[model samples]
Target: MDAEQAHGPGGPRWWRGRGTPWRSTLLLTVFVFVGSAFAARMQQGERAELDLFARVLLLVACALLLWRRRYPVAVVFGTAVAVALYLGAGYPYGPVFLTVAVACFSAVVAGHRRAAWTALGLLCAVHLLVAYWLYRWLPPSGDAPASLGQELVVAGWVVAIVALAELARSRREQWARERAERAQAARRRADEERLRIARELHDVLAHSLSVINVQAGVGLALLDADPEQARTALTTIKSASKEALGEVRQVLDSLRTPGDAPRTPAPGLDRLPELVEQAARAGLTVEVAGEPPRLSPGTDLAAFRIVQEALTNVVRHSGSRHARVRIDEERGTLRLRIDDDGPATGADAGGGGNGLAGMRERAAALGGTIEAGPRADGGFRVLAVLPVKATAEGGEDQ
Candidate 1:
């Protein structure tokens, strides 16, 4: 069988192919010989010898178990019939019935529920018929005839064997279901990790490339008229490139070995001044207000990214050169707002692109909300509110 089928629910183990049949056959042979000898010794008046015909029947029944895994129902019925015939011919009760019971158990464990139950019913019915024959035809001297208690004891044994088989089947199925669920959970975790990495790369590269593009244009414009201005622009380009490379390497290192300490602490709201300075070099003036509040690592990183992306948008899309940033925390909510006095420029003015989506995902993941749009007063605005602590239901802390 293929690997998938072999490892699937109720699937046989690999070694079962080479081991189970021979082991079962050997066990049945030992049971048949030892039990028959024990039964003969248990005889009261005269110990009856196992005739050649009865011995042959017992051997046949034991040999039939070699095919039990392949033909469980057939083996059960064949062995039961052989044992019944041997008993009818006045042969002692031995382990011939054991082969039948083992076959029935194997059938159930192999996922043959209907066949196994049918074999069990047929075996019980044959046993009842044999009991009646022995009670009517065979006279008892001093001992009592076959009683209902004896029949019940035999039926109880059959029921116990079937119950054990059913228990094993249920346990196997439960384990299979659990294994499948664990596999699915692992796949889901892998997919989520891939999406997280993709979003990180998009955010880092997009912001860095936008800054580099602006600096290169500035350098090219001033290369002949003002060499010093061009040199300053080249310096900004170099700085942006170095920052991008460091952040990219950090991301790659995280992917290589998760849980390792980062080479540098992640930037948070404390780094807003650096972001504003970078924007100033790109010819945009930024005004700031309110102090950064204490935040969870995730919320802090998300707040930084939101402000970074908003400033990058101001530089790349807004015509106005001045922007305002506001940070406020009150009653367990940390609020951030960035606005620029520039006319709306297409969808970029109203939140479009992976940057905005990434911002939204981050805020929402922390039980927070973000809103971006063109303000009625002729400027673009982005606002976000994050909870101090995330709730179990992923809602804002109350």
Candidate 2:
């Protein structure tokens, strides 16, 4: 049974929104009254005659169940007291035990096991006092003392009911823990995915927009004096904007249809020539050393974005017009180093804080590390060391 159902309605039809389970409790009430009346008939000669007081006691026990979820400790004790009174009145044993069992069950599952046990223990003690010692003062005159065997049987029954309730409480707690863990895991995955998207967007826009900004400036500078040169700058801006838009569309498409393969493959080190060409159009010269190596898609994309952002920073922040990129693989790791001989344009010229942070995030996701700062000489350098082989577990595309 669901843990919520333990405190509320029986099924969808019985559901009364988030309120008390009136319908199901009413049913239990009816069942207890009918069953106890039938048992009274069966024990007519052996027990006291059924009376108004006996029915009222049964009603009291069953009615307390209605508030079991709200006040479990009080309900269990209230039901136990009512049932003990009915027993002291020399009432027959039947479904009368059902009401107290349910109350104890609710209390235990609601994290009031000690209270439930205390109530149950006191009720059992009363049963013993009435059955074995106080029968002379109670109804059903001339009744013999209850046998040790019968008392033992009653003890066993109470133990079984409490044992079952304890088992239910354990299972409910386990299910709750598992549900919390699953929700936490889902939230963690969502946070990671959002971070990944932000990095992708930043890399795509920052690099392309930096190029467009440089070209637009050139176009404005030579618009009248050099018409052909202005036209060339405008052409470069158009190409950069078009490429940036396409990449942005790809990123948004992933959001629209998650889990599907991307229509355009993600950029990687194989696109280095294209990156170099774009930088050249922006009037920044790029030098490449060592051939790009085979890498897992995630590491490849991280490496590509790191170099792209480093070069974009050079174009935007560094006064130097030249940047060098070196790629090398050793053991099971790929290393990328980007360097610019720079007199930085401003104090905050280290790739706009977000760009460097994104690089660090990408490297950390791949169980890699990034080192980026000004060189001992008047220059800035970014070095990333990433594992060459691993499932692209941290990347969306792979």
Best candidate, TM-score: 2
lDDT of each: 0.76, 0.86
Tens-digit lDDT string for candidate 1 (1-398): 43224443333552246544787689769878888878867853432358788789889888888877766667777887787677666566666768778877777766666677787687677666656655445423232344788677777778888888889877876776788899999998787678666767766777777778888888999999999999999999899889889888876766766578888787788888888888887788999999988876667777888898888888778888899999999898999999999875542423347788888887887878999988998999999998766654442343
Error of 1 at 358 (Å): 1.8
lDDT of 2 by residue, 1-398 (tens): 55445444321222223467689789999999899889889988889887899989988998998887777788999999999999999988778888889988877777777788999999999998999899999988988898888788788889888899989878877776788799999999898878888899999999998998899989999999999999999999999999999999988777875578889888899999999999999999999999988887888888899999999989988999999999999998899999999988863322356988999988888888999999989999999999886445555343
* lDDT value for model 1: 0.76
In terms of TM-score, how similar is model 2 to the real structure?
0.89
> Relative to the unseen true structure, what is the Cα RMSD of model 1?
4.6
lDDT of 1 at 357: 88
